[model samples]
Target: MIRQRVIVHGRVQAVGFRFSARVEAQRLGVSGWIRNRNDGAVEAEIEGEAASVDAMLAWLDEGPPGAEVTSLSTADLAPTGERGFRVLS
Candidate 1:
């Protein structure tokens, strides 16, 4: 399994980014949580098989149609054996 913490920057807030991420994560059979940051960025931690995690990251790169993702940063993290995805407020 693999885990990653991602911070996405851009016009990411109030554009359904968190909900879209949850749907994508569930579809990919990955687990994690995504939330909006006060700094107008989106933050998330995803864990699952390497391929699934990679897929989730790719989806996050584009986000929903309204999002204009300018940049994103990621860091490796230990897997937590999580089972479902959530959108945190």
Candidate 2:
């Protein structure tokens, strides 16, 4: 399993990014949580098989239709065996 902490910038807030990410993560069998950062960025931690995680990261670049993802930053993390994906307040 692989895990990553991703920070997505630009037009991410108030654009349904979190919900869309949760849906995609679930579909990819990824586990983690996503939330809006105070810096106007969307932050998430995803854990799953390498292929699934990679797919998730790629999807984050596109995000929801209304979302305009300008850039993405990711960091490798140790898996915590997390289950399910969620949107955090």
Candidate 3:
């Protein structure tokens, strides 16, 4: 398993991005946390199997219905061994 930190840009906040991420991550059996950044973006840390991690990254591209995901930037990170996905306030 591996971890990735993704920063979603453009029309992400207040548009259900974090909520959708929570659901998607759980469904994919991923463990991580998602929250809004002060710079008007949504940041997330996801860890799981390789295939599942790829799936999550792809989902972040489109995001939720109301979200206008302009783009997403990701970086590799050491696995945190997180247990569940959460929407951090």
Best by TM-score: 2
List per-candidate RMSD values in Å: 0.6, 0.5, 0.6
By the lDDT metric, which is better: model 1 or model 2?
2
Which consecutive 10 residues in model 2 have the weakest lDDT in total?
A: 14-23
> Any runs in candidate 2 off by more than 4 Å, and if so which?
none
Can you tell me which runs of candidate 3 are displaced by over 4 Å?
Answer: none
Q: How big is the positional error of residue 36 in model 3, measured in Å on the Cα after superposition? A: 0.2
| Steric clashes per prediction | 0, 0, 0
- lDDT score for residue 24 of model 2: 93
Q: lDDT of all predictions, in order shown?
A: 0.94, 0.96, 0.94
Query: In candidate 1, residue 49 scores what lDDT?
Result: 93
lDDT of 3 by residue, 17-63 (tens): 89988999989999999999999999999999999999999999999
Candidate 2's TM-score: 0.98
For residues 1-89, could you state the per-residue lDDT of candidate 2 as single tens digits? 99999999999999889998999999999999999999999999999999999999999999999999999999999999999999999
TM-score of each: 0.97, 0.98, 0.97
Query: Can you list the residue pairs that collide in candidate 2?
Result: none
- lDDT digits (tens) for residues 6-26 of candidate 1: 999999998989998998999
